[model samples]
Target chain A: MIRIDAADDPRVAAFTRIRERDLTSRDGCFIAEGEVVLTGLLQRSSFLIQAVLLAERHEQRLGAAVQAATAAPVYLAGQQTLDGIAGFPLHRGVLALCRKPEPVSAADLLGTAPADAVVACAFGLSNHDNIGGLFRNAAAFGAHAVLLDGRCGDPFYRKAIRVSAGAALTTPHAVVEDELDLIAGLKSAGFRLLALSPAGRSSLRQVRPAGRVALLLGAEGPGLSDAVMSRAETVRIEMAPGVDSLNVATAAAVALHHLSGRVEA
Target chain B: MIRIDAADDPRVAAFTRIRERDLTSRDGCFIAEGEVVLTGLLQRSSFLIQAVLLAERHEQRLGAAVQAATAAPVYLAGQQTLDGIAGFPLHRGVLALCRKPEPVSAADLLGTAPADAVVACAFGLSNHDNIGGLFRNAAAFGAHAVLLDGRCGDPFYRKAIRVSAGAALTTPHAVVEDELDLIAGLKSAGFRLLALSPAGRSSLRQVRPAGRVALLLGAEGPGLSDAVMSRAETVRIEMAPGVDSLNVATAAAVALHHLSGRVEA
Candidate 1:
């Protein structure tokens, strides 16, 4: 472990001005914050851990995780220095810089799936929290993979990773070029496409999961485009009257739980 | 309608420095932002609407909602003035100050629920977003009411109400003194109590909804206290081996959806 006293230390340049880097380009590197996410980076993520920065106070509690990351250089700093490096009051006090994995094709993600696989697909999901929540739900429900359209936010983004409880690092995912490409690819892969929308023709309870199922989720407001919904079997959660819909991520959890196929006891 | 050109205008003081106000005291009045929440305030809430503030541009779009709030005066200002008053960019261009309704007891909320009702109860939920999401799920799944322990965050906070999609205003809710009181009340009301926890003895699918059901939820990490879970029948969502649990709000959504008692097609 190396000690980083100065916030401007060259060895820790990748961790500097984190809030700014979150918005701008990061040169193919992404930041994962908090101990849970850092553990995910060390253990679950397929990507290389570029480095790990932690507050000195957390070293005792997180020493095991740092030791487990044999390949990554561990940098420890005081809370003030760590906050300075992050450009914010990072109460969690653990952060990691990891390399982004090489891009995988959507076909490859679905081609190797098990016959009874469940995969989650998102289109135009701009909110990172929603993206993270989707991944968390997907992981909890034992989804084989996640596929996102080009318009969806990056699940590897800092907040997204934190909100996902590190599921973004562990879950296998591919970003398709667009909704049309995703639909065509899923159909070609022999996956039953189920789109979630308020105007869905089928209630969620009606859709019997058969073979491979690809559940499609859209953004909260505009939802799945008409063109996309027309191609997939649209399903809606029966809701109380006067209410329009559930949050995209919450809805995903409900649908994923049901589709997980746990027979009622 | 009132026209306010100055940011410091006393008539609109309640709407000034909203981000700060969110953290500090509000003198019994809460701020609701965005056009959607404003509509909830004007139409669904039992609380009295004290005033409404809008960017002049939204006047054309939200004029009907403003007009419907017969007892509240509407304040119109330019975008710059509105932003300055808010101490941030108020992109939604709509805000309202509404009086908080008088507090209701857990007994009263439970007493009013129908014999076959499904009510959601939250314990030690300190996060406003989770509280808001719970309310939204309760409303979406046709829950009759929501019961929150004293430790839960105020659902009327600006962000909570927004995150709830304005369900915080429309949904009937009560803050009980503590978890013990809430448990006793639900049992006395002849409601089947189900507590959601990772260590639950019963799987979610096993519990058949019989009559009035009260689903208990706790915070994400610690979850419901052991004492609270002991009194209620513990149920767990079947999950993948490695995952610990779903987000609190997402779990509530799944449980509420199942307990809503929809028949499969």
Candidate 2:
């Protein structure tokens, strides 16, 4: 591990002002914060680890994980210097920069999915926390892949990655530019699409998943468009009177739990 | 409505430096921000409304709701003055101070629950977002009430109330000081205690809600304690291998969806 004595060290410059960088593009790279996410970068993700930055105190505990990333150089700095480089408090004490995987098409992802797979599709979901929660739920419920329309927030956003508990790194996903194209791709793939909405004709319990299924979720206030709902089997969760709907991510978990096929057995 | 041009107007003292006040005690009061929560405070909550503060622009949009809270006086200020008083930009342009509801015992809440009821119980959940998510899920699934152990975060905190989508204002909840007593109360009240844990012996699909059911959820990392699991029917959602568990609130949503009796029909 190389010691970084100065926050402005040329080798560690990429790690500086992280909060500001999160708002802009990272070229082809993304930041993974906290020990859990760092571990995911080194161990689970297929992405290339560009480098690993660690606070001096965390080196002892995180050394093994860093060592496993033989191709990436490890940079160590004191807590003060690390905080200066991050432009914020370094509570997690570990960060890693990784190359984003090459982009894939929605058709390619659905074409390669398992015969009886479950997938999550998001539309107009702009919240990073919701994006992260969707990935976490997809991972837990064994969804084959996640498909997001262009309007959804980046799953690799630093906060989204942390909120996802690093599932963003391991989960296979693709961002489709057009909603209509994504819908057509799912239909051609012979996947049953279930769009969640408060105005659905059938309740969640009434629908039976016969084969491969895809659950479509939209933003909280403005639900799935009529065009999207018209093509798919629209379903709604039975909620208490006067309540509009569940949080987008919470609704995804409940729907995925029922459609996962794990419940059938 | 009273016009207040100064940020330091004594009539709006309780609304000043809200972010700072959030860290300290309100002496049996809580702040509800955003128009949605403010409407909930005025129309839904049983708690008394102490006052309402609004930016001049919001008066036209929120006038009807504020008028309904006849007992509480409304104070209007310019956006600049409102921001100065809040110590931050007030994007939602609305805020309210509400008296906390009188503390109810776990026994009292359980005793009053409907014969066919679903209740969510939380243990050691210290995160405000998780606490809020739990209430939102409980409300979405038609759970009759929510019970949090003393270790959980206050649901009435500003962020919690907002994240709960104002469900915290409408949901009946009680914070029990002791987990054991809460468990005993559920049992004596003839409620089934289903402790959600990763190591649970039965999958969530195996359980059927007969009468009154209470779903017990713990924090994310350190889940329900062994002692608590021993007395309850430990249940788990079947997940993909290598995943620890879903977020606490997501888990509650899935479990409550199953046990809520809404699905049984």
Candidate 3:
């Protein structure tokens, strides 16, 4: 590990103006914070490691991870310097800058799954927190992969990564151009498409899966588009009157747990 | 409706310094923001209304409700004046100050629930977001009431109310002194207490809940305390390998949906 004294050093330049950089910045790399997320980034062979910047105190705990990132530059700084460089308090004191992997196609992600696999798919899900929670639920329920429509937020966003508890790094995911293409791809892959909505014809408790299943979800307010819902068998979670519906991510978790439990059984 | 020009007027003093005054200075009243939450606060007969402060634009849409709150004072102000009074931009352009209802004992809450009812109980759930999500799930799954131990955050907090989609206002809830007393009260009421944990003895799918069931949930990381788990029959949600457990609120949703379905059946 190389010790750095100045926050403005050229080697640590990528870590500056984090919040501002989050929106209008792209250098083919994303920042993963916290030890668990860093560990996730390290485990994945698909993404190339660019560098790791951590506080001096975190060296002993993250020694093994730093050793593994030998090819990438490792910079060590005091908490103040690290915070200054990050444009925010570095409470976790660990960050990894990693190169993005080559984009995978929708066909490629769905084709590799088992015959009875369960996959989580999203449409127009722009909220990072919802996306992150969706990924975490997807991982917990053993979904084969997460399929995202183009309108969905980037799963690799820092908040999404932190909220997913690093599941965004580990889970196999891909973004496709059109929601229709995703539906057609899932259908052709011999999977049953179940669209989740408040007005679905059948209750989730009564669903009897055939073989493979793809759970389709939408954003909080508008829900799934008619074109997409028309392509899939609609299912609803029974809810009390007056309240509109469950939060999108919470709904996704319940649906995933149910479908995955059925598939595993 | 009364129109006021000054931001520091005593009539609108309860709305000032909202973020800072949230913790230390509550005088048996809380601020309810947004149109939906205001609607919820207006609908509840138990909570006494102090006054309603709304932007002039919303005066027409909320005219009927404002008229219904005849006993309480109604104040109108311009968007700038509302923003200045709130110490933040009042985009939703609505706020309500209501008196907290008299504390209800845990026994009273459980006693009022139906014989075959399902209740969501919490211990040490301090996060407002989780608390809000739990209430939403409880409402959606037809839970009779949400029982919170002393350690849980105030469900009536503004962020919690908004996050719950106003479920916090509509659902029957009570904060008790002791977690154990809450559990004991449920048992004596002929309700089966089911503690949710990752290391539970039986998978949730295998359990056929009897008459009344109270689903006990804790915070995300620490989970249910040993004292609570030992006293109740522990049940687990079967998840994929490697991942630890689902978020506490998400777990509550799945369990509540499962038990509510069984109870209804």
Candidate 4:
């Protein structure tokens, strides 16, 4: 175990940009924290261990992770110094920065995906928490994969990752450059392109189609662009009168629950 | 038109604490903002208008509100001073400190509430944004009222009001001292009390209850207290595989939609 209590350590630079989208532009990349999320990352073996930053008190707990590593530099810092470097208060004393995962191809996602995959097709969502919450909902309801559309923020952003509780790492997703093409692609694969809108003609629960079903959503305000709405099947979630619409993430949860056939009538 | 450019002016104190709670000791007072929400307050005429703070630029736009006679103080401030006092950029410059509405009896709520009213029955939720978001969802989903358990934070907190986009003022809620008693009261009154649980046995969409239904939810972490759950009907939202539970606010939105009967198959 290496112990150093310096806030200006060059090694800790990667953990600093977590609040911003540019997470550690160094060669060694990817950042995740918390025991629950870090366990999943380590179990998946997606990234090579670059360094482990932890408090002096947690040396034993963090040592376990470092001992199993093949090769990487380890830095130990005090609580205040660690907090200074991370730019936020972290509950779990451990943090890991590993190489980013290889980007998945659209074909890879499609080739491996099923016909009736409960999916969230995200478009124009900027809030990291919303994106994270969407993924968390997706994971809870048994979605096959999450497909990202244009104008959406990076899913790997620290805030999004924490809000998602690290499901961003475990859940499968394909980032498509063209939102229209992604919807069309899903439809061609026999997946029902279900768009959630206040003005949708049909209730989300009533629209029962065969095979793969993709729950289409957009940012809170300007929900599903007119073009996207025109291309996909329109569905409204029946709400009590006066209520306008649900948050994109919340709607995703409800849809996932319904699509998963888990709702016990 | 009145314009004062001092951050320390006593008038904007309540507005300044919009996101920060527990800083003031004065009871029976909460904050409200925006033209729609402020207008709704004017229409209800239930609470005292402690003070109305307006931006000089919005003098003509907010003329009608200022013209109303309610006995509350009307204070004006410039943009720079307002920004410094509030500590955050506000979309709308108008703010009002109104008296807390009289607490409603559970009996009255059940009897008068719409048969299909969507009520966000909160238990132990502390986040102002979550509370506000729940109110916003409740309002947007056409919920008739919000029944907050005493353990929950005050909805009149500036952050809560702002998070709800001023919908906090639009909705009606009866704060109860004992949540179990309220849950029982809801049950005895023939209101279906459906508790939101991630491990719920049934999906909300599959719930086919007739007459008055109350969508019951607890705080984000240890959702719906055990006592409340034991007394109320337990139901879950089906979600994608491996995803964690949705955020409290997001969950509320989904549940509100599901209970509103808009997602019926």
Query: TM-score for each prediction?
Result: 0.97, 0.97, 0.95, 0.87
Could you report the DockQ of all the candidates, in the order they appear?
A: 0.94, 0.90, 0.86, 0.59
Per-residue lDDT, model 4, residue A243, is: 55
Clashes of each: 0, 0, 0, 22
Candidates 1 and 2 compared by DockQ, better number: 1
What DockQ does predicted model 4 obtain?
0.59
* iRMSD in angstroms, per model: 0.5, 0.7, 0.7, 2.5
- Residue B164, model 2: Cα distance from true site in angstroms: 0.9
- Cα lDDT tens digits for candidate 2, B1-265: 8899998888899999999999999999999999888877767663478888898987876855677656678888999999988999998889888898888777788888889888999999999999998898899888989998889999999999998989888899998889888888899999988999999989898887888998999998899888899999999889988887899999998988888744557
> What lDDT does model 1 reach?
0.88
Best model number under DockQ: 1
lDDT of 1 by residue, B1-265 (tens): 7889999999999898899879987888898888888776667662468888988987776865677656678899999999999999988999988898888777888888887899999999999989989988999988989998889999989989998989988888998876898888899999999999989999887778977999999999999998998898999999998898999999999998899854332
Q: Which pairs clash inside model 1?
A: none
Clashing pairs in 3: none
Which residue runs does candidate 2 get wrong by more than 4 Å?
A: A262-264, B262-264
Order of quality (TM-score)? 2, 1, 3, 4
Give the better candidate number (1 or 3) by lDDT.
1
Two-way TM-score contest, 1 vs 3, winner = 1
Q: What TM-score would you report for chain A in candidate 4?
A: 0.89
Q: Which of the predicted structures, 2 or 4, would earn the higher DockQ when compared with the native?
A: 2
Q: Judge the docking of candidate 3 as incorrect, acceptable, medium or high.
A: high
